[model samples]
Target: MSPPRVLIVDDNLMNLELVSFLLQAADIDVSAASNADAALRAIAEVAPDLILMDIQLPDIDGLTLTRQIKADPRTRATPVVALTAYAMKGDEARMLEAGCDGYIAKPIDVTSFASRVKAYLARRAASSSS
Candidate 1:
């Protein structure tokens, strides 16, 4: 089977590199975008299986971008996992409300990031198959 494609969107180059490296190490095909505009463009081109989106972007916020992506029929079903530094009360719920499939706080645990991503991909695959 082909490796799942993942789009990692973050304003921080370091964060983008880190997430891309981790996902690549797990044998996933990763595309990195430094801003919302690039992210949207990449999504249109690559049609990634999943998106690791950072909340704070230079142009548009991740929540708004998530809503936009989900609102479009073509990309609506693609799972989006919010990657944020904000781990305060209700943040996760807010992200979910914005249409994120899952939430991962920043200062990511590289050891378990791949596993968490895989878990979501597995569920997505199962659901699609069914």
Candidate 2:
């Protein structure tokens, strides 16, 4: 089987570089988008195993983009995890309602970020096949 592929959509260059580097270190294929429009285009080009969506995007927010992604049949089964700093109450629930498969708070824990991503990918794979 091939290594899992991930799409990370974040406007901050720092966050994008960090996340992509970490995922690549784990042998995962990584793609990126700096804004919502780019993210949508990226999804149409390739169906990734998982998506790391930054909630505060430049154009359409990550929550809105995630909903669009889930609504589209071609990308519905791909797991999306909200990567946000909004750890406030109800934020996670809101992201979930918007169609995120998981949540990862910002200022990510470098040591565990890759593992958490892997967990979500595994979860998505299991759910789809079962």
Candidate 3:
């Protein structure tokens, strides 16, 4: 079987690169987009197994994009995770309410980032099979 695929949407070049490199090292196929428009296009083209969305995009924010992805029948089944710096009170609750399947805080821990991402993918697989 092919390696799992992940799409990361973040306007910050460094964040995007770091996450991409980490996932790649973990043997994931990574696709990235720097903005909402490009992210939408990548989603359609990549059919990513999972999405790591940065909450503050240059265009639409990540929560709004997550809602859009969840609303669409073609993409609803794919898991969307909020990857953001917003760790204040209610931030995670808000993201979950908006439709994110999971959450990952920003300034990610390089040591555990890949495993955490894989955990989400594994959850998706288990849920899909059931």
The prediction achieving the highest TM-score against the true structure is 3
TM-score ranking from best to worst? 3, 1, 2
Better of 1 and 2 by TM-score: 1
TM-score each candidate.
0.97, 0.97, 0.98
Candidate 2 — what's its lDDT? 0.93
> After superposition, which runs of candidate 1 have C-alpha atoms over 4 Å from their true positions?
none
Instruction: Give each model's whole-structure lDDT.
Output: 0.93, 0.93, 0.95
All candidates: CA RMSD (Å): 0.7, 0.8, 0.6
User: Which whole-number lDDT from 0 to 100 does residue 26 have in model 2?
Assistant: 93
RMSD of 1: 0.7
Residue 83, model 2, lDDT: 96
Separate clash counts for every candidate: 0, 0, 0
Question: Per-residue CA lDDT of candidate 3, range 1-130, in tens?
Answer: 9999999999999999999999999999999999989999999999999999999998889999999999999999999999989988899899999999989987899999999999999999999989
Q: For model 2, what is the error of residue 109's alpha carbon versus the real structure, in angstroms, after optimal superposition?
A: 0.2
Question: Candidate 1's residue-wise lDDT over 1-130, tens digit each?
Answer: 9999999989898898888888889999999898878999999999999999999998989999999999999999999999999989999899999999989998999999999999988988998899
Any runs in candidate 3 off by more than 4 Å, and if so which? none
Decide which is better by TM-score, 1 or 3.
3
